[model samples]
Target: MTIDGSHAEGLGEVEFDDEKHAEDRQFVRALARGLEILRCFQPQEPLLGNRELAHRTGLPKPTVSRLTHTLVAMGLLEFLPNHEKYRLRSSVLALGYAAAATSGIVELARPIMQRVVDEHGGSFALGVRDRLSMICLIHCHSKAIFTLRMDVGSHVPMLPSAMGRGFLVGLPDHERQFLVDRLARVSRRGGQTTQEIVQRAIDEFKAQGFCASYGEWLHDILSIGAPVISHDRQVVLGLTYSAFSYATARATMNEVMGPQVRQVAAVIGDEITRLRWRP
Candidate 1:
């Protein structure tokens, strides 16, 4: 399958069509639009005005004004009187805090991840796919001085990162292809499509039980990752160990870090099964 740039933007992102939604009585288009406005605010870009929200979300200016007003009234957004923009409020953080505080997997993975970091000498992260990116649920920083600028809630691209490849390779054939078709349009290597590269990564992972990223995502970062599979053979999580290339050579990563990440992934999978996580 082929994808265009627009399709790539929709991959893993929730999109709504009024025509399709009109057929379902339970579908709430207004709520969906409002949430899209709230999602526009990120840590890096905190404040956005109605015009920016309209431009980013492809909604009309009038619709953006209504949605922003509603979101602000609901406490999910706050109007910046000084800047005449809007920012995500504590309510958004509360929702994230609640989820993190209640995540049993993070609690279970903490000590094992610490051990992995102790031996591997790099930062470790456990995360799951969120559309075309992986969102870190737990991050264990390295003892070494060199590390990537990422932490919990950080978004890792699926096309280039080791963790993303591990997660994708763990998916079923149809689901994997569906996502690949969407991601291929936006992911490229040296002006060429990424299909061949991604397929090779998936093949290597299937054969070796792990995936590697030698500066594909960040030029200086090297990583090895393995997937955490559920009892039903579905990938539920991903584990990655990353460090500066100068600190750990690729050969060393393939020989040593590969096995360690695989072990940690298995331990995490076992715990998730023991806890009876369905997905």
Candidate 2:
């Protein structure tokens, strides 16, 4: 395939070892770095300078510069001529939407998730595991408070939040143990220890068949999440319903929302099983 200026721009990375990169077909680390650079442009910080991008992404300045230039050329990032800042372009959504269409969970869960959002008066989010995190697939917003700042392509860590814990609870003991060990080695962003975090998550998920988090990923937001398992009992999707405050969450659960989330998870699982997705 020919690599165009757009392709180079889309690469959005510079600090790569050619030999190491060639050794792996996935090149996951590079892909992550590139995506990180792109994601630095948010609704609030719509435009950012090279230094800002580097700070947000933890990529070196030279790497950020090269990546931004490439993205600008690719039409994914628009360079503000006089302002010397970069902003995301509409083309970025193409990649996200294409991925969603091809994903079985997104295709299967859309309607059911929408119903959950309608009944719950909150937001329903569907995600699938990608490497060490879950990438959001679909989000149906019912209230402004529950509406996610995250779009379809945002990645949530597999360690900190309820969505992550929901998936963890579905794993077999051996697999869970491995993840627990891995979690121990990772640094905590907040005050909790990794073991304490994982154990608490596992305990809650085991008890409730779902897990909830308050101010884990974002302050003032409360999220309740469950996992959608395939017929063979492998987790394929992580589902979440979230609200802005405790009062909002309490109201949602007391009304129709909590039951709807549970029901939707079961419906999604059944649909995937009917389609016979083994994994």
Candidate 3:
């Protein structure tokens, strides 16, 4: 869904609608709005006033004020009297750490990801879908002077990034279609339509084992990614290898990095399955 006035400020907004969930008894509108407020803060733009949060969330300023107050009370946000803004607190970090530690995927994938970057001289990352974007869960980088400026918790657009495309191809058909439709409704970068971009990725994944983004997401970076799915097919994750275009040619990405990422993804999927089966 398109958020009114959100594009004018060039800030990413959370995609949510109370009307969509109004009929569902399990859906809590207040809780969802509160979470959306929290999502408005990015790693680069952490401090946000209530007015900014309202604009990003497309919620009323009064409603945002209430939610921010509640979040501060809950220790998830801290209000700065001097700056008159809110920032994520240690509680949020603790919760995030707890979730990551329990997932077991980060621990399982780190070594393999590190080995790939160490050998290939690039960056390797694992990410999962977070609403309309993919949030990095783990990252490994080579000992190079220059590398991609992204870390764990960084967000990337789903339509343009190889990691996001890899995750999209892993979804069931109907589910993928739902997200594609949503993406089409929002403003997209580059010349290609959202459907065209997504369809190309789907087709590429079918023809090859992995999806590739040759400077589509970032003008100077090249990335190749593949999906890692749980044995039960419930959880889907994306694994990616990225490097500067000058350092790695597109032919090399198509031939070497693509297959390597695909193999690493398969290994991660098997590891996740083993973890699930452990007593």
- Of the candidates shown, which would achieve the greatest lDDT relative to the real structure? 3
Kindly list the per-residue Cα lDDT of model 3 for residues 61-175, writing each as its tens digit: 9999999999999999999999999999998878778888887777788999899888988898888888788888998998888877465777777777888989998999999
Candidate 1 per-residue lDDT over residues 1-279, each given as its tens digit: 111122123223545567777879998889888878876665546778998888878889999999898888888889999999999889898898788877677788889988877766778888887767777788887566655546577667777788888887778878878878878765644654567767877877877778888877676788887788877674467778888888788888888877888888988888888887643
Estimated TM-score for each candidate: 0.89, 0.70, 0.90
Candidate 1, after superposition: displacement of residue 149 in Å?
4.0
User: In model 3, where do residues sit more than 4 Å from their true spots?
Assistant: 1-16, 21-28, 277-279
RMSD vs true structure, all candidates: 4.7, 7.7, 4.4
Clashes (candidate 2): 1
| Per-residue lDDT of model 2, residues 1-279, tens digit only | 110122111112223344666777777876666778876553334678998888766678998888888888888898998999988888986776666677566667777777666665667787776545666677777654435545666566777566677777677778777767765665445677767777787776667566777767666677877778776775567788777675475555524454566677788888888887533
Better of 1 and 2 by lDDT: 1
Better of 1 and 2 by TM-score: 1
Locate the minimum summed-lDDT window of 10 residues in model 3: 1-10
- lDDT, residue 7, candidate 1: 15
Q: Each prediction's Cα lDDT score?
A: 0.76, 0.67, 0.82
Task: Pick the winner on lDDT between candidates 1 and 3.
Answer: 3
**How many backbone clashes does every candidate have?**
0, 1, 0
